[model samples]
Every structure is written in C-alpha cells, then in structure tokens.
Target: MGESGTGEARPPSQMIDERIRELGDWRGDVLSQIRALIRQADPAVIEEWKWRGVPVWSRGGIICTGETYKSIVKMTFARGAALQDPSGLFNASLDGNTRRAIDIHEGEAIHPEALKALIRAAVDLNMSRTRR
Candidate 1:
C-alpha cells in the first residue's frame, strides 16, 4: 500500500507507520528507544507497529513489543515466561500466562547488554518455535 500523505508504496506490514506517527508525546521517547534497541540488537529484524500502541518485531514469529504509559515504558516478550531471565528483569503480571514485561521508568537507565541478550534470546526462541 502507499503511504497516505507521501503516496510512496510500502510493504504490507509497514502500513502501520501512520499509527506510529500518531503516537502522542508521552510515548515518543519510549518508542524511539525501543526502535534503537531493536536495530542495535539485530539490524535485519523487521519492525511493525502493532496492537495499536506498540512496536512489534518479528522474524519467524513475534519477537517482542514496546509500549508506553504516563510513567513507564514496558517491553514485553511473547514467550517471555519461557526465557531464562537471569537478570530478573521479567515482571510476571498477575493476569498473564505466556508473557513477561520489563518496565523502564523515566530517568532510569536500560542496560544495553542485557536488552540485547533478551532480544537475541527472543529471536532464537521464535526461530526454534518455527522449526518445530
């Protein structure tokens, strides 16, 4: 499809660019950081705006998602419950069964190495799932 304003054709999955452009100010920083992390971790991974308010990356299956709220940026892994999170970054919510999240507060620092490890693990996990 073509971009609404630019009229330049884009891949189907990237059609969500418009939604990303519409994200409010509160979410911009978080989204930028998430995109940077994804690019640093794997330059080849495909990024798509999904779930209305999240940045989603995928290879064989969904890798992870980043969402923003008033005070925090949350990164979630689709199969997070299965990942070996030695850093204890995974936050197990009371209502979920296969997802895990890491919340980053304003002014807080995110460990790039740790984030990259998690990203790599997520990609590997998705690849393994597709192989089965």
Candidate 2:
C-alpha cells in the first residue's frame, strides 16, 4: 500500500488553511493566530476537520475547536471545565458543564502566552482522562 492507498483524502491541515483563507476577514486572522498558538503550545498537536467544517485540535483527545462566526472567533476547549484558568481567558460558554470558549472580537486583545498555557492545560487534561 502507498500513502494514497486509503482513499481520496485532503489533509486536515490544508482543509483548515482553506477555511481560514475563505474567511478573508478579521476572523481569519484571529483563527490563524489561535492556530499558531496551538502549534506553539503543542508541536505534536493534530488538526482535524469535524462537525461538517469546524477546525479541531487534538492530542490525547479533542483539545479544542475553532469556530468562527460573523461577530467573533470562538475557541472552545473540550475539557475546559476540568482545567484551571487562572488568567480568566475563557470568556464565553462559561456556563457549560464541559466546554469553555474564548470569544475573540475584532478589537479584543489576545494574550498569546496565556492562551498557549490554556492549550497545554487542555492537552494535559485530555491525557489525564485517557490514562484513567
């Protein structure tokens, strides 16, 4: 068997790049920044396309999803409720039982290092769950 032996498959990272380029808006830039930070946080992170088009990043399990809407770019953490957020970066979907999201508006300032820490925490949380 060869690399294409499986089927006609476009790489997940390329799909995500297309999605970002398709936006052609501030959301695209924000999502790109978030994506970069995720990679910086975990160089081994896996990018995935799921739920009909959403961009998801995973390590041991799903770490987060990048969902862009008209007004905001949302980064939703899968095990956010179980992780510690001392910097209070999570500003959306806070009431949820499991997921937590950070909504990035056009003018809002994003803390790159803080966000990276959060990403690492999500990865750690996912790893802990998988081990147990």
93 Cα displacement, candidate 2 (Å)? 1.0
Cα lDDT tens digits, model 1, 1-132, are 244467775663454444346665545556666678877988878876655435678877888887667787778788888788877777545257788888877777777788888888988888888899
**Among these predicted structures, which one has the highest lDDT?**
2
Cα-based lDDT at residue 1, candidate 2:
12
For candidate 1, the lDDT comes to: 0.72
Using TM-score, give the best candidate's number: 2
Question: How close is every model to the real structure, measured as TM-score?
Answer: 0.77, 0.92
By TM-score, how accurate is candidate 2? 0.92
Which residue pairs collide in model 2, if any? none
The TM-score of candidate 1 is 0.77
- Scored against the true structure, residue 4 in model 1 reaches a CA lDDT of 45
In angstroms, what RMSD does candidate 2 have relative to the true structure? 3.6
lDDT of 2 by residue, 1-132 (tens): 112346766788988998889999889999999999999999999999888789999999999999999999999999899889999999988898999999999988889999999999999888887898
